[model samples]
Target: MKALIRSSAAVSAFILALSSSGVLIAQAATTGTTTTPTPMTSTATSDLTAGPLTLTAVPSFDFGTATLTGTTGDKVPGSSVTGALKVTNPGQIGGWQVTVAGTPFTDTSGTALTGTILSLDGLATNPITADDSTNTSTLPTFVTPETISTSATVVESAAPSTSTSHIGIGSYTTSYDAAASSLAVPSSTVAGTYTSTLTWTMSNAPA
Candidate 1:
């Protein structure tokens, strides 16, 4: 009887061990799960630009005065001195204006000389004609023709040429168009080295 009891006790212990293992396996299965997220990369690009450029004349002019020889009182018919007006455009793209600083005037005499440029009041003693040449009607016919009666020439300019403008009446006016690279001087100018400072303003236009 004692031996039988011992065998039965061993069998019961084995069954209990199996039941514990089954419970552990069920718990593991219920909690078993995995999750993963996707990975990615992004990129972008852009382009920028600017507008056209602009250029203009500066405000400063540097046409030095002339040293007058003959007297303004001793007016002659055809006696006249010569002078030049220095014009220029400061910008990459050229521009236009009526004269070397907007108008022409004899820095020495300060006379209203550029009246006849046609664009002005048309009262200029001299007016510019064709071929950059000067003429009378545009130039004043002095009482003393020998003392003061002369004409001027419009010195042509290349891309950007150092040109001269003639003015006999006193102060003359001119116009400029940068695009055209052209300048205008009075038709009736004197024969001296007249000068007017021309300043330019730069442009932003494409080269």
Candidate 2:
């Protein structure tokens, strides 16, 4: 009986040892550690471009103050003086002309100059007297008074055209080619401070 009891206790001890060893082996297990990798991505995206344009104008001629150097109201009857006029385009351009205009002139005494009509409608016509008859006789008269006595021609783009004695606007334009211009004071330019002025106007062409 004693030996049997001893053998039983030994058997019990061996079983307990086996169970504890199995528990330790299971608890000490090292799990394989892994982290899920994160994915990376990206997204991307295009137009027309152009250049700049520009114009400028400049007057080539300037007529300084014109004073009558001849005798008072004693201008040559049929002789003319020449002067220059300049026109320019600073930028690339095409098709343009200059037209001139102005107010009539008067004497230093503030008297409007007067003269007989030499022509009308491009023909000989009766004399058109001055508005202020006080100045009418101021104009020179001839024994054989022609239908037209005095005239003015504003030369530009070409030789000036003759105009009957009067106070009004006179204009001219440049020829086909863009060029400088000149004007011929009428041979019969009356004496006095003829306050005639020139103005330049621009245009594409005859409308």
Candidate 3:
């Protein structure tokens, strides 16, 4: 009986030792456990700028040579010329204007041609054309020379974003049709080459 009891005690001691070993192994596994994570981010931006108002002169007027045949006090043979002006208004909210001034026709000897008249026709923001007196649709005439001349509303742009008729921010062109007439060539009129100068000015202010 005593030997049987001793054998039962030894079995119980072995079972308890096995349970302790399992618990120690579980604690060792948990001690080295760890985790980590990283965060990310980003950013963005934008900017807008306005452009400047500017003007550019295009081709000049060239009145080809002509021979005078009319009697004194009568209009003589003359020529007509064509030219243009270009304007750029980037982001402009208002309208603009263009003016033209011409010097008197003079010879190299500084002799001014008297009784001469210059006429401007087909003054428009688009392609310019000479005015036909017979056609009332043509532009007005500028008889007085050497003066700052303004045409009808060349560019009627609408207020910015207020109306669909406003001129946009971009380049615009204006063409001019011009004609010149010489007053009667005096019987004593000299035979020589003549020349003149035309100056163009532009402004944001309405004319």
Candidate 4:
């Protein structure tokens, strides 16, 4: 009877395997490939033109109104803006100078003022930077208490360039000091509005 039971159990296992569909299969996983980075480049530029050495700006002087003092010479101190003479250098030059002169002060009816003096007092020298910069070197000498001339007079001057440092290679400005400007009028001066033109001349002359 025990042999008969064991045979029945083996037949049942065989029938279960036969009733199934198909076999289960397992597939392996995989990875992908990669590459390194790359590099690139570009460019840029600018341009400059040569500028001429020249006097750029001239200042205007205004001496305030005064009463006629027919007894003696009259001195009037005046206040002014743009009281500096500005110059620019184009480089490749030795040095330079500035000369000053004035025309006769004339009234509306063409009457002229003779023996009138325009005194530009002590002017402070300025050192240049950038195109013309200041350094530990000898600077230009400026005429002080300058009694303006009918003819041209050297108001400011500089020595010739002995080397690169000596060359006048930048912009320059000589400014007026405090209460440094005045107009001197002779006795019996006309009591009317008068206008005068101050001629400022700049040159490449190295003195």
Task: Using TM-score, give the best candidate's number.
Answer: 4
Greater lDDT among 1 and 3 belongs to 3
Q: Candidate 2 residues 1-207, lDDT tens each?
A: 999999999999999999999988887775546789999998763232221111122223322344444433332232222332333322212223334444344557665544422211110121122234433122111112212222323222112112433211122112111111122244355544444343445443311
C-alpha local distance difference test of each model: 0.32, 0.33, 0.51, 0.71
Instruction: Assess the local accuracy of residue 83 in candidate 1 as a C-alpha lDDT between 0 and 100.
Output: 26
Q: What is candidate 3's CA lDDT for residue 142?
A: 25
lDDT of 1: 0.32
Give the candidate order by descending TM-score.
Answer: 4, 3, 2, 1
What are the runs in model 2 whose C-alpha is more than 4 Å off? Answer: 1-83, 90-94, 116-192
Candidate 4, backbone clash total: 4
Task: Flag regions of model 4 displaced more than 4 Å.
Answer: 1-51, 122-138
Candidate 2 residue 107 Cα shift, in angstroms, is 1.3
lDDT of 4 at 203: 84
Cα lDDT of model 1 by residue, 1-207, tens digit:
999999999999999999999999999999999878788889897754423322222223222333334433221111221222223322212212222123343546664454322111111223222222442112211111011012322122212212242222122223222222212334454545433333332222111
Total clashing residue pairs per candidate?
68, 4, 2, 4
